[model samples]
Target: MHNEPLAYRMRPRTIDEVVGQKDVIGPSTALYKMIKSGHVPSMLLYGDPGIGKTSIAHAIAGTSNLPFIALNATTSGKKDVESVVTEARMTGKVLLFLDEIHRFNKLQQDALLPHVESGSIVLIGATTENPFHDVNPAIRSRCGEIKQLKRLTQDDIIELLEKALSDEKRGLGREKIRITKEQVARIAEGTNGDARKALTMLESIVIASDEEDGEYLVDDAIIEQMIKRVGVFGDKRGSHFFNLLSALQKSVRGSDVNAAMYYLAHLLENGDLTAVTRRLLVMAYEDIGLANPAVGGHVLAACQSADRLGLPEARIPLAQAVAEMCLSEKSNSAYRAIDAATAAINKGQVGDIPAHLRDTHYAGSAELGHGGYKYPHDTPIGSFGGWADQDYLPKELKKAEFYKPVVAGEEKKFAGIYEKLKDFRKK
Candidate 1:
C-alpha cells in the first residue's frame, strides 16, 4: 500500500464507492447488474482522463471476482496480446482490459477479435476517442460500448473532495488538514468536475503546506497557486473538441463567415489540424451539399493542401476554404433529400429506376426497350414532360425552396441559375 501512488491508493474499490457517472454507474443500470451478477460483457469505456474509467474497470474486477489483466495499447503489441490471451485461456475465465484502446492499430485490434468471440476473455477497452470513428468496426462490433461522461458540475467535484478529506488512510485526513467549505468548493471548482484531478490537487496542497501542530489549514489562494501550476489544457479527450467543432459548423451553417473563421482559428491555436480538416469535409456535405456542390471539392482541396504544406502555410488555405463555405449560400436541401429517400427505401418504398435514368449502354439494353425512353438532353427545353417516375420528394419539399442566396458574390449567380432551371422545368 505504501508503494502505491496516492491516486491508486485512493482508487474506488466498488461501483458504489465510485463518484459521479450516475447515468452509467447507477444501481439499476445494466453495468451495475452485470457487476452484481458477475456476468459482465466485453465493454468499451470511453471518457476523459481522471474520470474513473480505469477505476471503474478495477472495481468491476474486484466485484465480479474475475482475473483482471491490464494492457496499455501504447506499449503492448501482438506478442503481448497473444501472451494475455494464452494466459486467459489457461485460467479458463479472465477479463482483459485495454486502456487507450484507440491507440491500437488495426492489426493489434484484429488479434483480439477471435479471443473475444471464443469467450476465453471478456475484453474491456477504454478510450478517449469516439469509438465509432477510432475503433475498427470489427473490434467495435464485438463489445458493448459505454460512454463515461466528463465531470461538468461543481457539486460532483465537491463530493469527491469531501470523500478525500475524510478518507484517513489515503487522503488528507492523515495530515490532519483543516479545509473550509469555501476552500473545498474553490478547489473542486478549480478541478472542473474531474475527481482524480481534485484529489491529486488536494494532496498537492497538503504536501506543500507548512504545518503547525499537525494541523494544516488550506486556503483558496494556495489552491489557486496549485491550479496555476497544473494549468488547464481543457479536455483533450471527450466532446470538448466536438463541441467546439459543432459551434464552428453551426456558424458556417448559419452563414456567419466571421464567426466561422474565429472558431477555425481557435481550433488551430489549441486543437489538431487533421481533426479540423475532417470536420470541414463533413460540413461541406452536411451543410453545402448540392446547393453549391463545388464547396465540397474546395474543402477537400484545402485538406489536401494543408497536408502537403503543413501548419502556418497550410492554415492559409484552410482559412480561405472556411470563409468561402460560410459566405457561400447555405443549403441542406440535397442532404435532406437523400435522407428522405433513404428512409423511404428502408421502409420498402423503393421503386424501379426511371427508364431514361437506367443504363442503355449494355448489349441487350436497347433491345429490351430501355433505349426507347425519351432523351431529356435532345428535347426542346432539355427536359421531356412525357418521361415518368414516382415523385420521390414530397410535393411540399419539391416546391419548398431551401437555399436562399445572400445576394452577394458568386451566390447571386447561383440563385440566377436555379431560377432559370426552375422555369425550364416548369416549361
Candidate 2:
C-alpha cells in the first residue's frame, strides 16, 4: 500500500505466486517434487539477474518450515560461514542461502563443503555466473544445480507486468493507474525481457503520473522517455558486460571476422583488455581447436606478452591475436571430440588404456613385459603392423569420428594427413 518499487512489492510470497521459471517450478519438475516431498537438497541456482533465483530460494525457505539465513558472498567470509554452521548445529536444519557464490574464492568455498556434506546446513547458493566455469568443482558437486534461463520473449515480460499490475498490495492498482496493452508491450521491449527493469520502469511511470486527476494513463511517450533516461543497460549492472561479450562471441561463432574484430576493438576501447584477452584465449580452444591448434598457442603467447608489455603495447598483440583467431581456419572439432568422449565415459564405457601405451619407465618394468611393445618407427611405413588397432575408442563410437576437418587453409593439410593415415591403416 505504501510507496515502494513494484518489483519489491510484488515479490511472490509463495511458490505458486512466483511468475515464470515454469521449467523449474512446473508440476513433476525436480525442485517442485523435492519441495513437495520435503527432500530438498542443497542447491545452486544460476541465471541472469531478476530471473527469480533468490525468489525461489526464499519460497523454499518459507514453505519448508525451516530456519533460513542469507549471506552475501561479496561481504561474508569463512568466519561468517563457520558462524552459520555453528548456529545450524543448535537450530536443527537450516538453509544457508548465499548470493553471488561465485565471488567466494577457493578457500571460502572449501570452508562450506564440510558443513554441506555433514548436513549441518542445507546450502542454497545463487550465482549470476555459469557454475560450470565459476564455481569450484567440489562445491558444485555437493549441490543439485538449477539453471534459470533469461527472459527472451515479449510474452514472458507481459506475464510479469500483468502479475505486478494486478496484485493490490504491490502493484499500482490502488492508485487507479490505467495502462494500455501497447504501453506494457513498449516497456517490455525496452527492458530487454528483464522483469525487474520492466516493473521498476512501470513503477516510476506510475509515481510520476500519480495526480489528483480522474485516472493516470501510461502512453508510449512516457515509456520511451523513461527508457532514454534510465538507458537500455538497465538497473542490473552486469548486463552491459555480458551483452557485449555475447555479441563478440556470436560474431566469432558466425565467422563474421570483421564484426568480431570490431567488437574486440569496442571492448579494448572501454579498457577491457583483460576480458578481451581471456575470451580470445578461450575462443581459441573452444571454437578454433585442433583444426588450428596453433591458434591456441598464439593466443596464450599473446596473453603472456600483453602481461609483460601492458596497455598500449599490449593492445597490438591482443589485436593481432584476436584478428588471427578470427581469420584462422575455424573448427570446433576438438570441442566436439572431447564432448563425445565425455558422453561415452559417462555412459560407462571407460575401458582400460592399451597395455603397450601403459607406463614402462619404472624399474623392474621389463619383468612385467611393460617395454616389450614394438616401436612404430622400427617398422616399414613407420607403424608397428597395425598395433595401434587397440580399442581406445569406445565400441559405440568406433566409427563415430567427431573431428571432420573443413577444407580451409591448414585444415586442408590435416585432412590430407588423415587420408594418408587411413590408407596406411588399411594397408
Candidate 3:
C-alpha cells in the first residue's frame, strides 16, 4: 500500500472520508442509509471516469464490516468470479467490488447471478457507461438500485487535494510541498472536476519538484510541466462536449476567428473528429445561410476529408472550413425562414397546396386542375427575378415574408431582387 500511487493509497476507506457525490452517499442519502443499516444489496454505480464508484464500494464494506473482495471486469474471468463465490460461501458474507462491470460479457456476468441472489455475495458493480445499455439484463436486474455519481465540483477537488497535501499516512505531508489555492484551483478546473486527475496531477508535481539550494519550490513554470498531462475531455456525448461545440459556432457567428479556431483545436485534440464534422456541417447551413451559400459545400468537403483521413492531417481541411466560416459574411436567413414558416403552420395558417403547385404528373391530374403551374421559365419579362407578382404562398400566408436577407455577401444581391419583388406584389 505504501508503494501505491498517492491516489490509490488515499482511496477513501470510510463513507465520511469520501469527498463530493454527497447526493449519492451523503448521510441522508438512501444508499448511505442502506449501507449503514447492514442492508447491502447489489448496486450498480454509474458515472464519469474518476468519480467515487470504487471508493464508495470500499466504504460499503467498511461500514458493514464485511470481507472485501475486489475484481476488475476487464481482466477477471469466470474462474476468478467462481473463486470469489467460493470465498463468499466459505466466509458467509463478502462485499464483491467489480470495477467496469459493463465490460463483463453476458456469460461472465451471468455467473454471478446465483451468488448475488443467494445473499452470500453483496455485489457492488461500477461502470462508466449507462448500465442499461452495457450490462447484461440479468445482472442489471439483480443490481436493482443504481446510484449515479456526478463529476466532482471544482471546490470538492480542491478540498481533496488540500487534504492529500497534509495527510502523512497516504499523501505528501512528509514532502512538505507548497501549492497556492489559485494553483490548486487551476489544476481542479483543468481536470474537469475529476478528483483522481487532480490528485494525480498534484502527486506528479510534488515528485518532480527540485530543491533550490535549501528548499523545494513549485512555481508556475513547474506547474506548467506537470499540467501537460491535463487534457481536454474527449467524450462524444456529454454537456461539456456540446458546450464546447456551441462555443465554437457562436464564435464563428460572432466573427471571432481566434476563439472559433481555439475551440476547433480543442475538440480535435480530444479525438472528436466525427462530432466536429457533424457540428461544422450544421453550422454551415444554419449560421452561414445566404451570406456565403457556397461555404456550405466547402464545409461538406472538409467533413469528407476529415472522415477520409482522420485527425492531425484531417485538421487541415477542418481548419480551412473553420477559417472560412469565421471570415465569411454571416447570416441566418435560411434558418429564420424555416422557423418563421414553422411558426405560421403551428399557428393554424396552413392551407391546402395551391392547385397549380400540386402534383401534375399523374394521368388524370389535368382534369383535377393540378397541371397549371406557371412554368416561370417561360415568363415574358425574364426567368430569374421574374414572376414578382405571383402569389405562390398558401392563401392565409400569401402576404407573410419568411426570409429577410441581411446586407452581406451573396444575400446582399438577393436582397435587392427580393425588395423589388415585395414592392411589385404590393402594387
Candidate 4:
C-alpha cells in the first residue's frame, strides 16, 4: 500500500469525498440515496479514465461496510472469479469491482451472471467503453442503470490536488511543498479534467524538485519542463469527438464565431481533417441553405483547398470558411422544404400523375387522353418568362405548399418568384 501510486492512495473512501459527477452521486441523487440506505445495487459505471469509477467502488465498500475485492477482467479468468465467489459465500456478500469488464469473453461474463443475480457478489463493473455497445446484454440486464461518469472539471481536479498536497498519509504533506494556486490551476488545465493524470503529474513534479530552506519549491519553469503538452480531450472515434463536432455546428448556427472557432481548434487538435471538413460542408447546406446560396460554393472551395493543403496549413482556409458560415444569414428553408415533401410522401400523400403531365410522346397517346400537354416554351409573348398554366402535381396535392422560402439574403428573390408563380397557378 505504501508503494501504491499517489492516485491510488488518494482514492475517496466515502461518497462525500468523491469529487464531481454531482448528477450521479450527489446527496439527493438516486444512487446516493440507494447507497446511504444500505442498498448497493449491481451497477456498471462507464466513462473516460481517471473519473472515479474505482474510487466510487471503494467508497461504496466503505459506506456499506461490504467486503470489497477488485479484479481486472483482462488478466483474471474463471478461476479468479471462482475465488471471489468463494470469498463472497464465506463473507455472506462481497463488492467486486471489475475493471475493463468489456474485455470479459462470453464464458467469463457468463460466470458472473448467476452470482450477480443471486446477490452474493455486489458487482460494480467499470469500463472506459460505452457499456451498451460492449457489455453483454445478460450482464447489463442484471445491472441497474449504467451510470456514465463525466471527466472531472478544472475545479474538481484542483480540489483533488490540494487534498493530495495536504494529506500526509496518502499525499505529500510531509514534504512541505510550496506551490501557488495558479501553478496548481495550470497543472489542472494541462490534464484535461483527468484526476489521475493530474495527481500523477503533481507527484512527479514533487519528486523531481529539491527542498529550498524547509519547503520544496515549484516554479513555472519546472511546470513547463514537466508538462510538455496539454492533453486534448476526445479521440477520432470517441463520443467526445462527435460532441465537439456538435458544439462547433451549434456555435456556428447560433452565430457565435468565437465559440465556433474554439471547437474548431479542438477538432484540429484531434487531427480529424476529414470529419471536420465533412461537417462544415454539411453545415453550409443544412443550416445556411438558400439564405446565402453562394456560401455553399465558397465553403466547398474552402473544403477542397483545405483537403489539398492538409492541416496546420489547412486550418487557415477552414477558419475563413467557419467565419463565413458564422456571419452568413441563417435559414433552413430548403432543408425544411425537402423534409416536408418527404413526410408527405411517407404519409401516403402521393396520387396518380396528372393526365396532362403523363407520357404523350411514346405513341398512340391521344387514345389514352394524354395529348393535352402544353409546352411552357411555346407560350405567346406578354405571358412570357417561360411561364405556362400547368398542373404538374397530382390532383390530390395540387395545392400542397412545401417550399416556404425565407425572405432573407438571396432567397428573397426566390420568394418573389414563388409568389408570382403561385398567382399564375391560381389564375
Top of the candidates by TM-score:
4
Candidate 4 lDDT, 1-427, residue by residue in tens: 1478899899989998898889999998999999999999999999888888999999988999999899999999899988988898899999999998888777677677798999998999998877878888888998986999989999999999999999888888777788999999999888888888899989888777777787788878878876775557667867668878999999999999999999999999999999999999999999988989999999999999999999899999999999999999988999999999999999999998988888878888878988678888787536345767878888999889998988988898888888888887777
Q: What lDDT does candidate 3 reach at residue 399?
A: 71
Residue 165 accuracy (lDDT) in model 4: 91
Q: Count the backbone clashes (under 3 Å) in each candidate.
A: 0, 0, 0, 0
For lDDT, the strongest prediction is: 4
Better of 1 and 2 by lDDT: 1
Ordering by lDDT: 4, 3, 1, 2
lDDT of each residue in 23-93, candidate 3, tens digit only: 88899888888777878888999887887888788877878899999999999898998888889889997
The runs of at least 3 residues in candidate 2 whose Cα sits more than 4 Å from the true structure, single-residue gaps closed, are 1-3, 105-111, 146-148, 210-214, 229-427
Tell me each candidate's TM-score.
0.65, 0.61, 0.70, 0.88
Compare candidates 1 and 4 on lDDT and give the better one.
4
In candidate 1, which residue pairs get closer than 3 Å at backbone N, Cα or C atoms, i.e. clash?
Answer: none
* lDDT score, candidate 3: 0.83
For model 4, the superposed segments whose C-alpha errors exceed 4 Å read 71-91, 100-109, 127-140, 210-215, 225-228, 359-371, 380-384
Using alpha carbons, what is the TM-score of model 1?
Answer: 0.65
The root-mean-square deviation over C-alpha atoms between each candidate and the true structure, in angstroms, is: 8.1, 9.6, 5.9, 3.0
Per-residue CA lDDT of model 1 for 91-163, tens digit only, reads 9878888998888887676677888888778888998777877877777888875565665478877887787
lDDT of each: 0.76, 0.74, 0.83, 0.89
